[model samples]
Target: GAGAETALLLGLPIATLALIVKNIYNGMFIPLLCHKADAYAEVGDTRGIERMHLISGIGLSLTLGIIVTVSYLAGVNMVKGFLDAIPEFIKHGLSVATGIIPALGFAMLARLLINKKVAPYFFLGFVLMAYLKIPVTGIAILGAIVAVVMVNMPKFAASQPAPAQGASHDDEDDF
Candidate 1:
């Protein structure tokens, strides 16, 4: 019981940290990249970013709210039943992990509002960290680099015109 309580306590801070890191990576960095790539113009004013933030925040809250509600209704009893069938340690671990899901959802919503590119990185990083047991910080850094590189590479490729596009009819016939 004491261990479970302690774990729940620890999970709060870890979840908060995870939320903060995810928000910064998605909301700030990815948006900057998108702006640079001309995928979307700068909000033009602080109000615009604020408006986007408000709209996105509300949208995210509504979506997650529904998901959480459904999960509680459909999953709580099922999970309890499953946990009852499992070992005590596993049940404890699952309970602790479940508390972090809300924070993770919030972080995901914040990112989605500001930068859509973050979803893939978040999912991939989450899979790598949770399943593959990769270091979270390292994977986060790697994901950032990969996102930046991938976002910019297409721009670089697009800047180079094909020779065929520049060739005259005579040159085309010669080829």
Candidate 2:
């Protein structure tokens, strides 16, 4: 909903709008179909499961096809104008939520990935991007290099020869 609202607010190109619509349709409808399919599976109805898959596949394809066809026929301007009647506050709220969506996604991902060992590097990348203004590609490359070096460090240490077992260290012997 926020995505669709954002699309309408920004008046994105037809392709982006159509993609957003398709994604929304899948996100809403696919899970519903899956839930029903699960119930059918519990009853051992294999045909129902097959039918559900067929319906979902064809429904999504047709939805995308229809959206593309109708939007092209109607023109983007009409679609853009279609949202003009909505209240300003609702649009503003959706815009704010859309802005926060990326941060929320990153936070969820970090919850899964940010363990003690990984925390320092995660913050390092954040600082590089947020404060140092380095691009993501540069940070990713740096991370890869660091990871390679860290992984091979133990091997490098192991390759070095050990000291002699009974080396004399007396001062008189040295003199």
Every model's Cα RMSD, please? 16.2, 6.9
**Distance from true location, Cα of 89 in model 1, Å:** 28
Q: Give per-residue lDDT, candidate 1, residue 77.
A: 52
* Residue pairs in clash, model 2: none
The TM-score obtained by model 2 is 0.63
Q: Please, what are the lDDT tens digits per residue for candidate 1 over residues 135-163?
A: 97889789789979998999999999876
Give lDDT tens digits, candidate 2, residues 108-168: 9989999999999998999999999999999999999999999999999999999888978
Best by TM-score: 2
Cα error, residue 116 of model 1, in Å, equals 6.9
Off by over 4 Å in 1: 1-118, 165-175
lDDT of 1: 0.61
